[model samples]
Target: MPMPAQEIEELIRAGIPDAQVEITDLAGDGDHYSARVVAESFRGLPRVRQHQLVYEALGGRMGGALHALQLTTACPTEE
Candidate 1:
């Protein structure tokens, strides 16, 4: 079974309370998705680490309930 976009968003929010998450279904199949996540905690992290935070938020859902995710992560800009 495929995962719901809302579920993915909720999961991320639960893991990273301050994160801003946007999820897009690329294939309309619920099996593929793209997510953009921004958080203050990511400020000093490397890109690889930023991505890892998102993957961790998914709680090992990759390659299982969630098939694939194209993720982009960043820290909020200072004003």
Candidate 2:
């Protein structure tokens, strides 16, 4: 089974409660996706680390329910 966009968002929110996430299906197959996330937790992390956090949030689903994810991570902008 493939992961739904809402489910992906939920997983990311679970990882970073205050994260602002946008998810899109890239292939229309539910396996390939793109996600943009902004969160306070990512304020001091490197880009690689930020992506790692998102992958971890999926709980090792990278090759299963979730396949390819083109992810963009950023710290929350001051407002």
Top model by TM-score, which number?
A: 1
Writing each residue's lDDT as its tens digit, candidate 2 over 1-79 gives 8889999999999988989999999989998999999998888889999999989888898888888889999997788
| lDDT (10s digit) by residue, model 1, range 2-38 | 9999999999999899999999999999999999999
Which regions of candidate 2 are displaced past 4 Å? none
Task: Evaluate all candidate structures by whole-model CA lDDT and list the values in order.
Answer: 0.94, 0.91
Pick by lDDT: which candidate is best?
A: 1
TM-score of 2: 0.92
Clashing pairs in 2: none
